[model samples]
Target chain A: MSAPLSLPERLPAISLDDVSRTYTSGGSSVAALEQIDLRIARGETVAITGPSGSGKTTLLNLVAGLDRATSGTITVLGMRVDGTSERELAEFRAHHVGLVFQDPHLLSGLTALENLVAARLPFGHWRDLQAEARRLLAELGLGERLDAPPSRLSGGERQRVGLARALMGQPELLLADEPTGNLDAATTEELIGVLERVRREHDLTIVVCTHDPAVAAFAERVVRLVGGRVDGQQRLDRPGPLEVRSLEER
Target chain B: MALSGALAALLLSGPSHGYELHATLEAELGSTWVTRPAQVYLTLGRMHRDGLVTSERVRQETRPDRQRLTLTDAGRQAAEAWLAGGPADELVVRLAVARLVVPDRVPSLLGTMIEERTAALHRLRGARADDTGGFRAEARDAEIRAVEGQLHWLEGLRGHLGELVARPRVRPADERAAELA
Candidate 1:
């Protein structure tokens, strides 16, 4: 019998090699992160978790090309992100990376559909964008709220809109910073459900920066950031009966 | 009875040193905790020496040392009795202890901990619904449905918790919040 081939290890969508960030404040240099090394494979959902000032947010910004590093190289979606020019990074983010923050920085005047359609403006096509936006919203259980503005939408609904806005461009990589940071308990759980469904359906790579264990539980791997460096990691699998039993037993 | 009960409750699940027990409890309580592994091992060693339980060296591939542990008949009985009895105030106290010690981390830790619990509940529900035919056929659908319902409820709770941890709190019962005004 021919040897069965295992699933090919997916190529990393993001790589940070010996990356570090330092800030000079009042003639004293503070290290935000140092000696960071990470690899995020395509289609993988990885959670970056830590306490405040642990460099979790800094790591996200670096990957999204929102900020530059003081040392080492960051490669995002096959482009060298660390040394990329400002224009290059902006273009790269627009084309390859989709960002969602804790707060839905949605345009106040725009409807949910309009906000989603806006992602296509930079690329100059709004026709298909609307249809895709509707499809995404409906899939995320927001079809009824599509015409609502940010002010009228509930916390969960708004977060779904923000998620739809991110997916409107169909970017290969999604970087979210505490996407549920401003919701109620019920809404947070609902948002996580939507995220789980979308992640599987879209087959997109998502890196979420959160300290919430609930959020981390969904990720295949949870990387701990400490003192601005990769500290340790926890590997989690889809919880099964055996695992539940183990947990209960534990 | 309180200390013995909590200790037993932890032990009933499996064998753990005092430190690991503390960590698990802290995690369950959703607090920023500091329980050194060495300290746990020390307690286990002492417990072993005291005849509360018997332990043996267990080799783990990823660990540096063989963890010494095993619950004896006395230990299991103690654990079961403790858990079966009732809740203890100290259970909350330990969590408070962890929270107080790590005062700066209260909000973040609580947020993370709530998230973890919510996720864990979802996962447990999902696990129960697997089409393995392991669960009874008659109870399967009802159980799965119940799990799904709980998952939804947990989401709502998590959302509310998120809002509480962060900004201006909105009273769910308040007419303004109801109107989104």
Candidate 2:
């Protein structure tokens, strides 16, 4: 491992400079995101908000190394994400990034806890990942449901389990897309609170794409996307109900 | 009772004055909620006595003391329960509370509601198709048509979505039909 992290100050968790992504089909193309520039400092929580076709998921995929930029550059943990080979990118993500989705991809037959255990089985950190999975599940209030299969758990419980699996890798960066999309208000609040505590305790940098104002309120900054571009960015000061939008807009 | 639940749900964010709560409720629920100032104050007073909210008089330098209100732990729990609990008949009140409590989730809630109704409609039609023409067949078909109309209206909302809700990414008709089948 090159271990590029010994710099003077740990570099920003994520840096994107003039990035653009285009998809081509039938000799025509669609620009999913263009002229985007953003930087997320270490240990900060930022929320990405937007309507459909706004490239919110595209941005997350690009950061996670699941997709590549057509131009420009992406640097995460002081490593170049754009130009990295697929094998290198996979290796980097396994060591650094955690991903949570609206519908978590868990093995149907496995128990909640086992799902986590099996994720890193290929990498052979069985004991460490298991310990982390158990601790994370307990902390997330799913300790009682640890043995339940995915189908048996409630939507909220399953999402919490998804979070535990994400944390098992001990990743420094967490990317969640519509994490609270199917959750109830109380569950949403609880999950966001958990994320906040994890960020504080672990010094993890989080980038979440959400539609919920509560998520935006808890974030250090909110970056809004529109028509594949950065529409607005705001650093919040716990403005409570007004944090997401103004009274007039509501 | 719905307003009382709504009030409890609103304070889950934190503290607020009665006026601000009323204004926020009015803004969120819009014309559907026509609560008056006196009603809001009366309800707050009642909630204070019931231990749902704690009220304190915050003294301003240039003005009279204003009553500031905050939710008790009990209040928060009750609101959480109320926000997450609703039968089909209570959908309107429940959704209003959801919109007020978690504005970011309105679109998701709406989408879930629509899918559920559509599924119910499909079941009703399925039962009719396999029926032997019972005595109540006509009445049952009417109920099915009503649900179909509601589903149409809900689907229609997606087309004219505003800034608050994301415009849904509709799948191909064939895909949706296959899933439903």
The most accurate candidate by TM-score is 1
The residue pairs found clashing in candidate 2 are: none
Off by over 4 Å in 1: A1-9, A238-250, B1-122, B128-181
In candidate 2 the C-alpha lDDT for residue B35 amounts to: 78
For model 2 the TM-score comes to 0.56
Query: What value does the lDDT take at residue A83 in candidate 1?
Result: 72
lDDT of 1 by residue, B1-181 (tens): 3444455445654665554566655554444334455655565666577676666666667755555456778776665444332322233432233232333443454444434444444455345334566555435445434444543443344344434334332222333444885
Candidate 2 docking DockQ: 0.02
Error at A61, model 2, angstroms:
0.4
Expressed as tens digits, the lDDT of each residue in A42-66 for candidate 2 is: 7677889766898999999999999
Give the poorly placed runs of model 2, Cα more than 4 Å off.
A1-10, A237-250, B1-181
Docking class of 1: incorrect
Weakest 10 consecutive residues, lDDT, candidate 2 chain A? A237-246
Per-residue lDDT for A1-250 in model 1, tens only?
1122235547888899999999899999999989898998877889998767899999999899888899999988789987778998888787778899999888999999999988678775788888989999999998898899899998888888988888876789989999989987567767877887878688689999986656666677789887897877765544433222233433
